[model samples]
Target: MRVEQIYTGCLAQGAYYIVSNGEAAIIDPLREVKPYIELLEKDGVKLKYIFETHFHADFVSGHIDLSAETGAPIIYGPNAAPEFDCIVAEDNQVFELGAVKIKVLHTPGHTMESTTYLLIDENGKDHAIFSGDTLFLGDVGRPDLAQKAASMTQEQLAGHLYDSLMTKIMPLADDVIVYPAHGAGSACGKNMMKETVDTLGNQKKVNYALNQPNKEAFVAAVTDGLLPPPAYFGANVAMNKKGYRNVDEVINQGMTALSPEEFETAAESTGALILDTRSNGEFAKEFIPQSVNIGINGDFAPWVGAMIGDVNQPLLLITDKGMEEEVVIRLSRVGFDNVLGYLKGGIEAWKTAGKETDQVDRISAEEFKERLKVGESVVYDVRKESEYEAEHVEEAYSRPLASINDWIKDINPKEHFFVHCAGGYRSMIAASILQARGYRNFTEIEGGFKAIAETGVPKTDFVCQSKVMKA
Candidate 1:
């Protein structure tokens, strides 16, 4: 028997592949299905099942497409009513895959249909549990995401989550491996550890939610400090519940290459937003006027979902020449399938054609310090509130990048200021958005706070996050 955790770092998501005796099962796949198919073909195994932990909100799952291709049944836990055909397995029901068995444990609480799949090896010994969003290595899934769908308050869902963990999960043996769906960087759970896999015993000791003395404490702990879900989350969930365009069709449509003039004309005709997916430094140096930059090298997909907010927003791409398809695929992962095309020869072609370009004013941290020594300068720290609270440049205002759309109107265009994130990526993104909106009175610090911290700038000691949030 072989169990593999296919971890995608960008999403911090894990999909599982388990095979035993020429039969295999996939758990919570990504939007792209070709890789899984190739792996199956190479292994000479028939895909017997596609298991969905829940209708995911972060990225569209490939269950529908994978099932269509492999003729494997898409299995869900009880109370799931997806638009497509699938077998809704009851709690405790077990399915055979060649020499092994996978038992369904209807855990719920992350979502009504959330489940954990327990793998029993050919020797009839419990091997591992693919503990979807229901349980992370150091945290439990946030219960707020399913409030609207389940018609339960976050507290109520947290209660269910407590019961589910106490009963369905905690009873497992200490040696049983726990494979979670997401890790530290994911928005699915706030306190997830960096490690993707852990033994159940270690989780019981280290995970806060698992050690709660009672359901009340568990509910309060789990529901605390949840930021609002990203704007595109519900739409992604809808696309997953109903169906979505085949990834191949989306990719093929997005692969259309257009000359500079054609790209300009298409943008005008379709009113598509131009998304530049180059590195932060390159994008800051020069880009098409009014184009938004969310660099492909960073947390590209989730940032796109958070900043763009609308999946149906038509987008034209300005990517590094060979990265067009990758940008499209990442966009598709977050359910942004309306990609019009890409700039044929990238920004170089546009510039060669005498197109007007824009650039953000950037300064090294040392330069910023020299300027600060000369006089008072407005500075905006675009890091998370928690990071800002931990330690930030004294007098830097907390206007997190995620909440930029809400707080941007407060920025006085005439006032010159400095902007920075942890390592300049988000600050550049913020700078581009600011420029697109005609706000040009800001300089982005070259290396963000990481650089600023090294320049002997006056920084505040640890403070309460509430103060930062209020700012």
Candidate 2:
């Protein structure tokens, strides 16, 4: 028997492939299904089932497409009513895959249909549990995401999660391997461990949610600090539940290459947003006048989902020559399938064709410090609020990039300022958006706060001070 965790770093998501005796089962696949099909063909195994932990909100799962191609039944736990055909297995029901058995444990808290699949080896010994969002290595899934769908408050959902972990999960043996769906960088859970796989015993010892004394404590702890879910999350969930356009078709439509003239014409006619997916540095140097930059090298998909917010927004691409398909695929992962096409020869072609371009005024951190020494300068820190609260430049205002749309309106267009993220990736995204929206009186720090610190800039670290007073 072979069990492989196919981890995608960008999404911090894990899809599992398990095979035993020429039979295979896939768990929580990504939107792209070709690679999965190739793996099945190479292994000479028939795909017996596609298992979904829940209807995911972060990215569209490939269950529908994979099942359509391979004729494998898509398996879900009880209370799931997806638009497509699938086997809604009851709690404790087991399915045979050749020489091994996969038992369904209906652990529903992350979502009503959330489940963990227990793999029993040919020897009838429990091997591993593919604990979906129900349990992460250091944290359980956030309960807030399913509030609207389940008609339960986050506290109520957290109660269910506590029960799910206590009864369905904590009872497993210490040696049983735990494979979670997401890791640290995912928005699915707060405080997830970087490691994707861990032994159940280790989790029981270290995971906070698992060690809670009671359901009330568990609910309070889990729901304490959840930020609002990204705007595109609901749309992605809808697509996963109803069904979406075939990924192949989406790719084909997005891969259309257009000359600079044709690209301009299409953008004007369709009112598509121009998305430039180049390196941050390159994008900062020069790009089409109004194109928004969410560099492909960073947290591209999630950032796009957060910043753009509309899954059906028509987008035209400006990517490096060989990166067109990749940008399209990543966009599709977050359910942004209305890609019009790409700039045929990239920005170089646009420039060569005498099209106008724009550049952000970026200065090195040392230069920023020198300017600060000379006079007071407004600075905006684009890091998360937690990071900003921990430590930041003494007077830097926290304007987290994720909340740009909300706070941008308050930024006085005439007042000049400097913007920076931890290492400049997010600032570039902010710069692009600012420029696209016609606000240009700002400079972006070259290396962000990390560089600014090295230049001897005075910083403020948050300190909790309490004083005792006597009457």
Candidate 3:
């Protein structure tokens, strides 16, 4: 038996391709099924089975498309999967595909239908178990998503999660390698290791979720620090159930470039919005002037999905060559595919053609501090609540970038707000949001809060995340 791990970095999602005796099975596929199709062709393996650990809440899944393309039956656990036709896989059910025998284990907690697949390799020995969301390298997925607020309290779901971890998943052998559906940088779990893989034995010793002395502590740990899911989460899940439109065919139909004058006509003709994936500095200094500034450097995918509601529409790229194809592919991973094409040489090409350009002023942290010393400008530390609690600027008031727009609307729009986050990425996001919301007088403090601390700005014990030392 051969096992291959497929990683999608942007989403920190992992899917597996297992081949035995010329038969292939894919577990937890993303929206674009082309990669799996190509892998099968190259390896000369026939597609046999497709399985989803649970109906995902974050991204639109490719299970239906894989089932349709491969003619392989799509399987989910006994707990109901919404939106698609599927075989309800049973616990302890053994299914053979080529030389591999797969035993399904029902492990609910991440979601009601989450499952673990135990694979017996050709040598007739137990191998890895694909523990989707139930367990991770060092953490477990938050139980708050399906258990919505005010209805099923966080404590109730945490109890269910405690049971799932203790009784269902912990019984597996120590040697069994654990393959989790998600890794670090994923919102699915709070403390996933940066590594993509781990073993049951290692996680047993280190994973805080399982290391808890009892269910109460375990429940408390997993129920916190969940960043809100992208605004488009519900829409993507809805689309996944009804079966999303074909992104490949939509790409094949083709799109054309247009002058600013022709842009309106193209928008009328093709119905695609021009997406500007540039830094707030670049977007602010100058632009095509009509595109939406959703930079590729930050959390670009989910926001793009949220802003561009229709996946079938054409996407005009307003990014430099360094960021173009990547921006397109990231969008594609989330099932957006109406890419007409990018500006040939980016905005510079259009500008050289005598087209108009737009501009906004961006300032460094040093300059903002100098201004602050003179009492001319103010700083808005735009980070998340958890992030603010972790660490931030000394004098700058913390306002999470996610909700900065709503926070400052009642105040001055031209308030000399200098923003920052854990790193510079979120400051860029805050800068863009301010730009989009017509707050042009703001400046993005360079290097975020880190820069302020580096300058010897006095801060508090809460300024840096030192509690991990206790852990």
Candidate 4:
């Protein structure tokens, strides 16, 4: 038996491939199904199942398309109300895959339909548990995401999660492997461990959610400090529940190469947002005016979902050469399927055609600190509220990137505000959005707060976040 955790770093999501004898099963796949198909073909295995742990909110799952292409039935846990055809397996039901068995453990905490799959090896010993969002290595899934769908408050869901972990999960053997759906950097859980796989015994000892002595303690622990789910999360969940355009069709429509003029005309006609997926440094140097930058190299997909706020927003791409297809695929992963096309020859083509371009001034963190010392600049710490409260420059404003749309209005556009995130990734994103909205006179700190902290700038640590609010 072979189990492979196909981890996508951008989404911090893990899709599992389980194979035994000549049969294979996929658990919680990404929107792009081509890679899974190729793997199956290469191994000469018959695709037996597409297992969905839950209707995910973060990225569009490939179950529908994978099933359609391979004739494999999509399986869900009880209470799943997907519009499409699927087998809703009951609790404790076991499915045979060649020499091994996968038992469904209906652990509905993350979502009403959330389930964990227990793999029993050919020897009939429980080998591993694919703990989908129900249990992360260091945390349990946040219960708030399913509050609306389950008609239960986050506290109630947390209670259920506690029961699921105690009854179904914690009873497993010490050596049983725990494969979680998401790792650190995912919003699915508050405190996921950086490691993707851990032994169940280790989790029981270290994971706060699992170590809770009572349901009340568990609920309070799990529900605390959840930031609002990204705006596009619900839409992605809807698409996953209903169904969506085939991955191939979406790619074909989006990967069209258009000349600079054609790209601009399509943007005008379609009112598509131009998304530049180049590196932060390159995008800061030059880009089409108003094109938002979420670099392909960083945490691209989740940031796209968080910032764009619309799954169906039509987008045109200005990607580095040979990156157009990748940008489209990543966009589709977050349910942004309405990509119009891409700039044919990238920004160089636009400049060659004498098109007006825009650039944002970027400075090293040291230079930003010098400016701060001279009282020549205002700092806008665009990291999350939690990050700012943890540590920030003494006078930096607490403008989070997640709520940039609302906060952008409160600040004067003409004022010079220096922006930074933990590192440079999110600050550049903030800078581009500000630029698109006609906010100039700002500089992006090259190394963000990490570098700023190193520069001996006056800094403060807040005992409570509310104390540091910037007006």
lDDT of candidates 1 onward, in order: 0.93, 0.92, 0.72, 0.90
Sort order, TM-score high to low: 1, 2, 4, 3
For each predicted model, how many residue pairs clash, with residues at least 3 apart or on different chains?
0, 0, 0, 0
Supply candidate 4's per-residue lDDT for 123.
Answer: 99
Query: For every model shown, what is its TM-score relative to the native structure?
Result: 0.97, 0.97, 0.88, 0.96
The full ranking of all candidates by lDDT, starting with the best, is: 1, 2, 4, 3
Per-residue accuracy of model 4 over 113-178 as CA lDDT, tens digit each: 999999999999999999889999888888999998899998988888888889999999999999
Tens digit per residue, CA lDDT, model 3, 1-471: 888899877688899999988998999898778888899999998998897787776676778778888898888886765666778888888889898898898887777777888888778777899988888888887787777522576677778778877887788788888999989767677778889888888999988888888888877777756666555555665666567666565444333444555554565577567678887667767875456777787777766765555666677777766666567667766667668766766787777778777654556657655666523446677765656666655555767655554675755874566666665666665565556557777666666677766665545457454343211
Cα displacement (Å) at residue 25, model 1 = 0.3
lDDT (Cα, tens digit) per residue for candidate 2, span 111-205: 98999999999999999999999999889998999999999999988888899999988888999999999998888987788899999999999
Q: Model 4 segments beyond 4 Å from truth?
A: 374-377, 461-471
Predicted structure with the largest lDDT when compared to the true one: 1
Model 2 vs. true fold: TM: 0.97
lDDT of 3: 0.72
Superposed by TM-score, candidate 1 places the C-alpha of residue 185 at a distance from the truth, in angstroms, of 0.5
TM-score of 4: 0.96
* Model 1 residue pairs with clashes: none
lDDT tens per residue, model 1, 150-179: 999999999888889999999999999999
